[model samples]
Target: MRLADLTTIGVGGEPELIVDAYTREQLVSALNDAWDGDWFVLGGGSNLLASDEPFAGTVIRILTSGFARIDGAPEGFQRVSIEAGQNWDEFVAWTVAQGLQGVEAMSGIPGTAGAAPIQNVGAYGQEIVQTLVSVDLIDEGSSEIVTVPASELGLGPRTSELKRHYGEEPARVAVIAGITLDLRVVGTDPAPVADERIRAALSLASDDAVTLAQIRERVLAIRASKGMVLDPTDADTRSAGSFFNNPIIAEADARLLPESCPRWPVEEVAETVQVFDLATWDGQVPRVEAPASRVKVSAAWLIENSGLPKGFSLPGSRAALSTKHTLAITNRGGASSDEIAELARYVRMRVSGEYGITLNPEPVFVGVEL
Candidate 1:
């Protein structure tokens, strides 16, 4: 089967074979067999960029679907377990209809819920790490199914132990069978919203009280504006959402960036707030990763400032930057995988040459290099 028909970017070459697994047992068997042979597992195909050359192996498509609200999880929270192949936006829409609150800010994200924790998917100040209680995964080595707590996943801004970045193997080689989220239960009423990032994203007043549905709409609108939301007719949406990750660099290197560039500290103020009683507190300071504190610079800002503006592309190439967001490298109708890679390489070269900092891509690459 051609990956061009399977991936969102619509640029890849064919695979040796395509197998769709619609049940848990079928999925497990497929993974086990793939481990013994050359194979690749594909999910929603939203976060991948493959080569125009053939994949040279079997491709297993995850098509399983199921979701349930499990009993005895926690108080004031709804614990729901979702199969790996369940459509992400569909699940978010369902949660909004049910009056759930935690994932409302992540409303229009593409891909499946199972792919969420792999990259610690987040938007408007909300992330999967906040509510992800556990995940049922299949270990590639043992071929055994087990439940792993969210804490052990080591989820950060856009990383986890299980996400395989370019030139870097994931800390763990396992496939998630199901994801369990413990969402805040708002029932059916407006809740006071206080997350600054979310408020900024939605352009809400600090004191605004909003319902889960309202948050979802605002988030979806924001994503659509940036072409982050999927639309078959929109050429800007024909790409892996963000071509590059926001570069997380040392504070010293960040100071070299232009003052107008947007940046965030790894150890954010929200996480370091003091809530303990001062009168009863001891004098000892808690140990922390001093070097863990970093500065995340905006990749989009660098791209534009480095002379690659929105919709920019090499002459005669069909790959272009998203008109709405510089972060996305889009297929301007019939763009080849090589064309996409060329654009990516050009962007990286320009940005690095101008700023001396390398920007890493966010998508998983298969049979392609930049």
Candidate 2:
């Protein structure tokens, strides 16, 4: 299968083989087969950035399906289990309809449930780590199916044990099968007067019974405006969500920015703000990497100020920035991966020349390095 067909970016070359597994048993069998022959686990294909060259290895596309309630109070709280292949936004919508509050802000995120905990996916001031209870994984070395708690998963800032290669080689392949989340159920009535303030703080209004569905709708609306939702007709949604994780920097370093820069404390010693640099990768690539020492700046802001306005492009070029958002590089149609890369590089260079900061890409590149 062509990587362009599988990825949201609509770029990349073809793969050696593409196997879609739609059942749990089939998924497990496929993973075992990949382990025997060596293959990569491909989930929703949202966070990946593959190369333009044809991939030589097998691509095991996870398609398993199922969702169930495993535990928690039937009246006030519940633990829900979901298969890896279910669309993430759909799952969030379903949970919201049931009155779950834990994942309300994560609505409209592309990809599958299994991929969520992989990076502890977060948005709008919330992260999967906050509510993820456990994950069922296939340990490649032992060939055992293990259920690991969230803590054991080693989740942090778009990384996990599965990503860090803690106990195995860097390319060690493991297939995530499912996950469990602990969700709270808000009752119809407001809490007693003594606890009213606390309930309000949590967004549980005194007269309004906020169900999960309402929360999901609101979250989806917010994501849509930001071009985070999936919409094939909108080129703005043609790439991964945010291209960079906001950088966390020391409080002293953050003070160097203009007073208009937003500041928030991530830890006692660290404060973060989003800054953008267009001169990243030394002008060879338009990329953004979040350094641990400086507050993460907005790539969009850097691009606009660097003279690359939204929809900026070379004359007669097919690739351009999304008109709705400056952070995305869109395919005006038939745009190659290299073309997209070039535009990204241009943006990065311009931003750097203007702001002395570099922008980094958030997508995972394969077959080609930028």
Candidate 3:
């Protein structure tokens, strides 16, 4: 089967064989076998780019799905467990319908729940790390199933231990089977919005009261306006949502950009791991301070200011920047995989030449090079 038929962008060649795992047992068995040879897991196909040539590895598509809810937890938080194959937006909608508040700001994200922690997916200042409890997975190294907590995933901006960045190995290897989340209950009552980013995204005034459902609706609307929500008829939506990640750089480098450019402070978190002998060692704790110096710059702002505008296209190619957002590269019907790569490289080159910064692609590349 051709990956084009399964992917959202609809541009790719055939795979040697495509197998779908509909149950946890089948998924686990497939994962165990995949470790013996070349293989990769496929989720919602929303954030992937395959080559025009036949894939030379095993492609396992995870289709297992189940949702379990446990109420009346500590401080009245709702605990829910869901399988990897469940659609993320559908799960978000379910939370809104149930009057849960934590995930309401991330309403229109594509892909599956299992892929969320891999990228630490977030929007409007809300990320999966905020509520993710754990993920059940089969480790590739030992071929054993294990439940990994959120703290061990190394969750960061669009990255985790399971994520494969360009020209770098992933910190960990495993197939996520299911995920658990914790959300607070508000009983369908309107309350003051807590996050500033959400308020700005929705253009709501401070002190404005809204419900969880309202937040979901407004977030979906914002995504739709940016051509982020999937739609068959909208060519702008025929692409991996964001092609490049917002670059996190040193605080000094961030100041070099134009004052008008959008920038956010990314604090450098220092986690100390110390081992001490509790039985004999004297109880004297030493504290040292380290400087926090990091900032995340907006890739879209850099792209536009670097001479590539929204809707810009390469010569004689069907690949172009989305008319609604500069961060996305869309397949304008019948585009070749090579054409897409050419456009991506051009964007990276221009941005680097103009700002002395390198932009990294966010999608997973299979049988393709850029």
What's the distance in Å from true for residue 121, model 1?
0.4
What is the per-residue lDDT of model 1 for residues 27-124, given as tens digits with 9 covering 90 to 100?
Answer: 88888777877777789999999988887787989898878898756788888999999998899999999987789888888888789999999988
Task: Provide backbone clash counts, one per model.
Answer: 0, 29, 0
Model 3: lowest-lDDT 10 consecutive positions? 65-74
Best by lDDT: 1
Model 3 ranges off by over 4 Å = 141-143, 268-292
Q: Which is the winner by lDDT between candidate 1 and candidate 3?
A: 1
Q: Which ten residues in a row have the lowest lDDT in candidate 2?
A: 189-198
Point out the higher-scoring one by TM-score: 1 or 2: 1
Give the local distance difference test score of model 1. 0.89
**Per-residue alpha-carbon lDDT of model 3 for 225-280, expressed as tens digits?**
99999999999999988999999998889989999989888675677767889997
Each candidate: what lDDT?
Answer: 0.89, 0.71, 0.88
Misplaced by over 4 Å in model 2 are 36-38, 72-76, 164-173, 187-211, 269-296, 352-356
TM-score of each: 0.93, 0.80, 0.93
